[model samples]
Target: MAFTIPEGLHPDLNPLAWMVGTWRGKGRGEYPTIPTFEFAQEVTFNHDGRPFLNYFSRSWIIDAEGEIIRPGASEVGFWRVKEKNVLEVVISHNTGISEGWVGQFDGPKIQLVMDQGYSAPSAKIVTAGVRLYGLVAGELFYAYDMAAEGQELQAHIWSTLERQVD
Candidate 1:
C-alpha cells in the first residue's frame, strides 16, 4: 500500500508522517503484581498542520477468545519533533497519572524514556518508564516497559496493530 503524507501536515512532522493514522490490534500484558492478561487496543495519531502530532489510545482487557472483559487504560498525549530527531512527549492517563517523556526517532523506530511524572493522591506512582514504537512489516509495533508500585522497570505490554483504512 502507498502511504501519502497527510495534507497540511507541518514540515517538522515529516519524520513522523507514517504514524498519522488509527491502528487497532490485540496484545498481552503482565506485571509483577498482576496476572498475565490479553487486551485489545486502538491508537490514533493526527495532525492539524501543526508541528506536533495529537495522540489518543484506549485499551481493554480481553478474554482468551478476544472478547472484551473490561476497560483498561486510556491516554491522550502530544508528540513533538525537535532538531536532530529528538522527540518530546507529554501524556495524561485516565488513571490520574501524567508524564513527560524524551527520546529520539530513527527512521521508523522511536524510543522514549520517562523524564518526569505526577500522580494523584489516590493513584499509583510510576517511578520510571520506557516506550518503543516501530513499523514492522506494515504494522505498528508498540511496547511499553514501566516501573511502578515499587516494581522495577520491565515489559508491561506489547502489540502489533494494522493501520485502519479510511
Candidate 2:
C-alpha cells in the first residue's frame, strides 16, 4: 500500500515523509575484524504534524534460516526546517555511541553530514564522522562514514529499508 502525505505537511519534510511507516528488511553489515553478519531490522518513522519525525530502529543478527541471534536497538532524534536550511539528527545507540548531524535537503534526497559526537548522557567530547541518507524509489537508503579510535573515514554500513505497514 502507498502512504499519503498529510495535507499541510511542512515543505522541508517532504523528502522524508515517504519514510513515515514501518519497514522490515535484511541487510549485511561489517565492522573492524568482525565477520560479515546477516541481520534483519525493523525501522519505524512517525510524525504528528510536527517539524520533525520520530524514529526508532531495532536490528538483530539472523542465521541462514532466518532465526534471530543478536539484538540491537537505537533511538534517533530528528529535526527539519528549523531555520530554513538545515536538517538535524541526534542518534543514541544502546551500544554507547551518540552522534549529532546536520544536512540539507535536495529534491527527493537529503545529505546529512555528521557534525559532532559525544558519550551518552555524560556528553564528553569526542571526534566526529560522516553519515548520509537519501530516499529513492520508495526506499530509504543510508551510508555511514566514521573515524573513531584514530581510524579514517570508512564505509561502516549501508541499508535499504522499504515501507512495510502503517
Tell me, by TM-score, which candidate is best. Answer: 1
Instruction: Find the 10 residues in a row with the least total lDDT in model 2.
Output: 120-129
Q: Against the true structure, candidate 2 has what lDDT?
A: 0.70
RMSD, model 1, all Cα superposed? 0.6
Evaluate all candidate structures by whole-model CA lDDT and list the values in order: 0.97, 0.70
Q: Write the per-residue lDDT of candidate 2 for residues 49-155, one digit (tens) a residue.
A: 77788778888888998799878556566655556556788777766777778887765577777787767654333366666666767777766666655566676
Per-model RMSD to reference: 0.6, 2.9
In candidate 1, where is summed lDDT lowest over 10 consecutive residues?
1-10
Clashes of 1: 0
